[model samples]
Target: MPNLNNVSSPSLWQRIWQGFLTTVGTKQFFRIFAPWVKWLAILASIFLVIGSVWGLAFAPPDYLQGNSYRIIFIHVPAASLAISIYFALAVLGVIFLVWKIKTASLVAQALAPLGFLLCVISLITGSIWAKPTWGTYWVWDARLTSMLILAFLYAGVMALFAAFEHTANRGKAAAILSIVGAVNLPIIKYSVQWWNTLHQGSTFTLTAAPKMSADMWMPLLLMVVGSYLLVATLAIYRTNTLILYRDQGKAWVKEYIRGQNK
Candidate 1:
């Protein structure tokens, strides 16, 4: 068998670390905040925070749902992103499974936790939103039910990936399930729309919109942007850590380890 532990004579580790950092290190992160990605996340977050706080605190209560509507800002973004993450995870999962591309699997692993976080936030916020709106904290409503399924699926994905003592089967299994879950998200999203259901219509859709004025929506949009950046930036950072873990004993790792010694 070929020697897998192929450490080079001197500085191979330094070369690899530089290459790894090339895609998304601190410099790239600054670009996202100030130059690239339009810094849209930060800008949008400002508007969102202002809009959410003002609307939640000082805006007039809905004549119908009353103060409970305040939860929409939190619930809507969480719900939207939870679904979005499934699609992303599925695509990345498929790539990882097909290519066995080390980077892709690392990314999928990094993103699993974020997906779960969004799902949990969506569930908790949905429950809170429902309490005043539906007169109960728990419901078998279509939207709630589907969203719960999403959260569980995310957990399953995470669990599969983290079953690393069984690494070979774990990666393959997680990737397949993530892709399968992605296919189900749209089905879940549209279930309420297609059938008569207790869950409310979508907030930003043409037929259904927020029952609020412009002052109310501006911040909600901002929050959505901020949430996306937060997830993405965190994912990238986590992926870096995972790559290091996976590659720790490589020639590159040894060379870099030596460089730090000098």
Candidate 2:
């Protein structure tokens, strides 16, 4: 209460932006984030274990599909992560292209493999779910086809990064491909609604109440949240590894390695 009015307060967005800039400005950014990433990974692991166990053993089985429906706990989360991570890659791509942020490019490179893995998991799980529900494992449906295209896009980005020898050139090519591939995200999201596909509409939406009951959705929500954190932790870990090698000549990195060895 003592002259509090004299103190300046930053807005929420300003504080967030400043925090981001502070992280990006530091040479020891990985060291600063390593503990946080460790914690995030631990939290993700706990939630993932809880969610998977709950969904597999305790969630009520679908009246129509029985226990087979439990796979949604994995498939939905994988699919959601696949799309969400690509969107993240696109954002990183923009940052790299516009600002030439080396960290952003490194992070995008780190995320490519993880994104592709999640996409593969989504496709395989979807196909497994399909055989029991629709009597076929593969279909040329819009949603399915679009998701396949997404996988190819991920592969393409990874390939482009490797195809170039110059680091800047590699980043530019990968960033361009990532930005262009972002169009596929909307296509994947809307394919079920856009066409007469066998794929089911979303069980949840921003504007509508969840189509699923709480017992069915609670674990799904947990899985989705946990998967996001898991991917983020992995991406950060990968980026830190890459940065250590890329910035090996930097004094801080050498000091960090020396400390680790000690």
Candidate 3:
């Protein structure tokens, strides 16, 4: 046989693609992120406590809604996170489908429950806020209806994943559902504007200054940041645990277990 030592190395794009896969495709990805989870949790707690106190106790009440509007501190962040998490799931779906990254599917699986919880929180809090503001606990308004649909989409994705016994099939089904469900996001986002709805337009926007004063918006900002950090902490920690459980039969996982026991 001819000597094969002179074979050409991988092209630059191939090398880059392989490097990307190596970074996110294995347990090493969890190893890199696991250490940050504790710190993220700590920071999340601190921000949430500070933000809650500031918004509830110190922030000036809305001139119109009075103290009742304070619920936005909780409601807005949860709603924002619910949508953001679903968007992330959609992106992960694309990643898994395109690259066949097992870790992306794992992370998506870890995030779905948290997203569903946030969606529920948003709906409950919005309903409570609505009773005072809209004189009803619920409505068929576009934004509200769209949000409710989002909650159902989250449920459907979870159910689809659980329905399948084969790992690859489960991931693929859930991912396809997630991707298809993303069509609802824009509808939810534009519902208030598209129809005459009880739901108000966005209070915060990148293109313009906040409609509210500094004292009002500051705590809301803090709360939003805290909520994101909290989600990150939970998602990363959950993903790491999942990685361990799924890879338990592998050599690296066995070594990790041995090290922990030691």
| Candidate number of the best lDDT | 3
- Model 3, 187-247: lDDT tens per residue? 9999988888999999898899999999999899999999999999999988889889888
Q: Each prediction's Cα lDDT score? A: 0.73, 0.89, 0.92
Clashes of each: 2, 0, 0
User: How many angstroms is residue 135 displaced in model 2 relative to the true structure, after the best TM-score fit?
Assistant: 0.6
Q: Using Cα atoms with residue i matched to residue i, what is each candidate's TM-score against the true structure?
A: 0.76, 0.91, 0.93
| Model 2 Cα shift for residue 133 (angstroms) | 0.9
Off by over 4 Å in 2: 1-19, 25-28
Q: TM-score for candidate 1, please give it.
A: 0.76
**Cα RMSD (angstroms) for every candidate in the order listed:** 9.0, 4.6, 2.6
Pick by lDDT: 1 or 2, better one = 2
Measure candidate 1: CA RMSD.
9.0
**Candidate number with the higher lDDT (1 or 3):** 3
Q: Per-residue lDDT of 1-262 in model 1, one digit per residue for the tens?
A: 8876895554888789676556443333333332433454455556567766776777676778777777877887888888888888888787777755556666788888888898898889888877777788897877778888888899998888877635566577788889887767876789888778778777675576665676666666666766776676667667656655666777665665687699
- Residues 1-262, candidate 2: write the lDDT tens digits: 5899988899999999888877773365686777878799999999899899888999999989999998899999999989988998999999989977778888888999999999999999999999999999999999889899999999999998888746548688889999999999999999887888899999787798998889888888888889998988999899888888778898998898899999
Candidate 1: Cα lDDT at 62: 70
